[model samples]
Target: MDTITHTLFGLGIYKAINKENMSKREKQTLLFTAIGASQIPDIDVISQLWDTSGQYQMWHRGITHSLFLVPVWALLFFILNFFIFRLKSWRFFWIALLAVFIHDTSDVFNAWGTGYLEPFSNARLTFGTIPIIDFVIWFIFLLAFILSKKGSYKESSIYRISWIMIALHIIIQSIQGYALYKQYEPRYEQLALSASFLPWNYSVIGKDENTVDIIQDSLLTQKHLMYKLQSSDNSNLKKLFKQNPKAQTLYKWSPFVVVVDNEERLGIYDPRFYRKGQSFLFEFIEKTQK
Candidate 1:
């Protein structure tokens, strides 16, 4: 998910807490804990400064997002709040834990997955069931926020209801994505699904022996073939990897890639981000001698 979504989720979590008896200082500390814990995992972005190998693709959502690090982050926040807020309750630690856990787990639903298992496993676990920036989520939270302000009901009740609505939306989207993925499974040797920005819509990439099929599909209509590509036989992937280290890292980071080899160029690109005539994740090298 994007930063805005994460921050909103943090705010929602903070608002969901029952602070009827707490003082203004305690509530303020709670707000900081929720927001900070939600964003701590993204600290891995700084690794690019020291990563000369051009492996920032792998580093961005790497070990810092690991499940094992959730408690570590929570502990850090707990200690910080202890001195800064001078609050002696265990409630601060629990809220920090919830915030960090939500941050790590929410990332698994998108195409750009996180290394949730980290030291135990290096796999980038992605379901591709939801877009990185989902308008549905934003709308739900926004509506809940608006309603909560107008009502005489407790604010925590309103925010908790909003969380439930968000969960239901994710479940419905996941079910639709899984059904679409299974529909293309028998026909293709390998398949990947990327949820479109619109609800119940998906971009399905299917690869067979020598061709790749990119389909735009929705539950309401028949699948439409957007692009059909013939796999290149002349791609010397080892040479490409040697020439462009980023290509090697991309290959490792993504579930699959579309290899491009022609008279003018040799390269590979992740098909998930392929748009118009090119892909943003593409990396290539000139065929002529250096």
Candidate 2:
């Protein structure tokens, strides 16, 4: 997600809880806190070098990214704010919790490429069901809040309800992601490439016994498509044609997507369409999944 989106999300959170009772300083502080703390769950991405002996281990997102860390960071923030601003520790508690909780929760939308279970598990859980920047969410938040002050745009029931709905949608996204795989995963081995490891890991397109495919824009990324033919499963295939026949069209459109065909040089998922040999790009291939 873009920084602007993060800031907008933070602003949304600030509006929800503060409603009406907050100082200007408190408002600004909340905005900062939301953006900063929401990024906290990602701390696991960096835990490796800090591990010193490499023996350090635990469920990656187990605790720190859980419901438990909300108050812990709040207390730490409250205590810190007390010394820094001579403010009441009790008052700062909600501010801290709101900031941190929103941060972690907002991030859960990213396909577990970002950890939601940090300190509990290292698994990068993701739904891959929707694009990172959801247009529906973006439009709703953008239109509700004005760029400049329009009276007490500081708070509104509409804003509060709007956010509640967004949160619900995100939760549903996670479930939809899991369900997609549950419906198709059993058939993956038979339908997917023999080389198929965790084909579903990169992008979540559930497989049938006969086929597995992750759809993307091929005009943007030329070459190599990951496709699976079923060992026997054909149910999803029946549905696929019924829904859209152009499935897996991205890879089919571009032969250069064949990264394995030329093992010496890999065809990367090029965003902004970077040309090959300009810089090296890497992916955790499905083959590496354990």
Candidate 3:
């Protein structure tokens, strides 16, 4: 999920809490706990400054996003609140824990995924069920906010209903994506899915031997081939890897990649991000260098 959505999640969580007897100091501590915990995992992006080996691809959503680190982050927040706000409420710690857990777990449903297991596993666990930016989620939360303002229902109750609706949306999208993925699973040696911004739509990348097919998939529509690629021999991977170590990292991080070896160059890219005749992740070395 995107930064804005995560921030909204934090705000929503804070708003959903019953604060009838809470002091101003207590409310401030809770607000910071929710927002900070939600954004903390993404602090790994700073690793890019020191990433000369091109491992930022693996490092960005790496250890910090791990499930093992959730409790660690929650403890840090709990201690910070203790010192800054003189907070003694154990409920504050639990709220921070929930915020951090939501941050890590929600990332798994998107195409970019995360190193949720980290040290125990290097796998980028992704469901590819939700787009990074989902308007459906935005709409649900916005509606909740509006209802909280004008409706007779309590603000916390409105937000709680919104959370339930959000979870249902994720489940529906996942089921749709899974159904589409199984369509190509039998035919392709490898498959990757990227959910479209539009609901119930997906981009399915299927690879078998030297060919890669990118298809627009949906339950209501027939699968449409958006792009087809032919993979080149990686026989000279030594040179390719030497020139673009990022490509190597991408290969290790991604579920699969489309290898490109042509008269001009050698490279590889994850087809899930393919668009407008090129991929955002392509890495290549000119053949002329050889």
TM-scores of the candidates are 0.96, 0.56, 0.97
Query: 2 or 3: which has the higher TM-score?
Result: 3
CA lDDT of each prediction against the hidden true structure: 0.89, 0.46, 0.91
Predictions: Cα RMSD each: 1.4, 12.1, 1.2
Model 3 TM-score, all chains together: 0.97
Query: Number of the top candidate by TM-score?
Result: 3
* Candidate 2 Cα errors over 4 Å, as ranges: 18-21, 40-68, 147-154, 171-179, 190-203, 206-212, 215-290
lDDT of 3 by residue, 173-261 (tens): 99999998987799999998999999999999888988899999899998899999988745567778888899899989888888888
Separately for all candidates shown, the number of backbone clashes (residues 3 or more apart, or on different chains) is 0, 29, 0
Candidate 2: residue 256 lDDT (0-100): 16
Q: Per the 3 Å backbone cut-off, how many clashing residue pairs does candidate 3 have?
A: 0
Candidate 3 error regions (>4 Å):
none
- CA error at residue 197 for candidate 2, angstroms: 26
For TM-score, candidate 1 versus 2, the one ahead is 1
Judged by lDDT, which candidate is best? 3
Worst 10 residues of 3 by lDDT: 231-240
Q: Which stretches of model 1 miss by more than 4 angstroms?
A: none
